[model samples]
Target: MDERIEISMLLDFYGSMLTDKQRDIMYLYYNEDFSLAEISEHTNTSRQAIFDIVKRCNKILIEYEDKLKLLEKFMKLTKTKELILNKLNEIDSSCDNIKISNSINEIINEINNI
Candidate 1:
């Protein structure tokens, strides 16, 4: 994955655990695509302070992912979802019986529940 995309995912997974200010800085830097100096100006802090906070937030997000692994599980589930959908499509196309059609719909509903 791209570094920016990975950080965005990490932030999504663990951002609630961060301080309000930490989240804000990270949001601006990553989500809003703001430069460090721009973040400093927006937050009224020194650029060095903003830089340190961004660095710390990155460490914290990575630590949370290392221990919690929410992102990993999410990626796995996403891949599994695709596989399930493909298999369901195959099964649906191969079986035209009404019962099999209903079963496929049920299976699709269950996948959506997941």
Candidate 2:
């Protein structure tokens, strides 16, 4: 995965563990695409301080992912769900089972929402 994307996913998985300031800084820097100077100005801190906080938050998010593997499992399950849906599509087309296909699609949608 791309570095930015990976960090974004890590933030999603582990952001709640961070302090409010840490989470807000990360959300601005990563999710909102704010520059360090921008975050510093917005938060009334030095640019260097913003930079340090962002760096620490990034490390903490990675550490959480490394230990818990929640994001890893989530990615694997999402991929598996996609594959299952593809196979189900193939089978449904061949077998002409509308009711079964609709039921499977509903289940897949529920899983995706999770």
TM-scores, all candidates, are 0.88, 0.88
Task: For candidate 1, write residues 1-114 as lDDT tens digits.
Answer: 998899999999999999999999999999999999999889999999999999999999999999999999999999999999999989999897989889998999899889
Stretches of candidate 2 exceeding 4 Å from the true structure: none
Scored by lDDT, model 2 comes in at 0.88
lDDT of 2 by residue, 1-114 (tens): 988889999999898999999999999999999999999999999999999998898899989988999889998998988888787667667766778878877776776676
* Model 1 lDDT at residue 9: 92
The Cα local distance difference test for each model comes to: 0.94, 0.88
For every model shown, the clashing-pair count is 0, 0
Query: Model 2: which residue pairs collide?
Result: none
Cα error, candidate 2, residue 98 (Å): 4.3
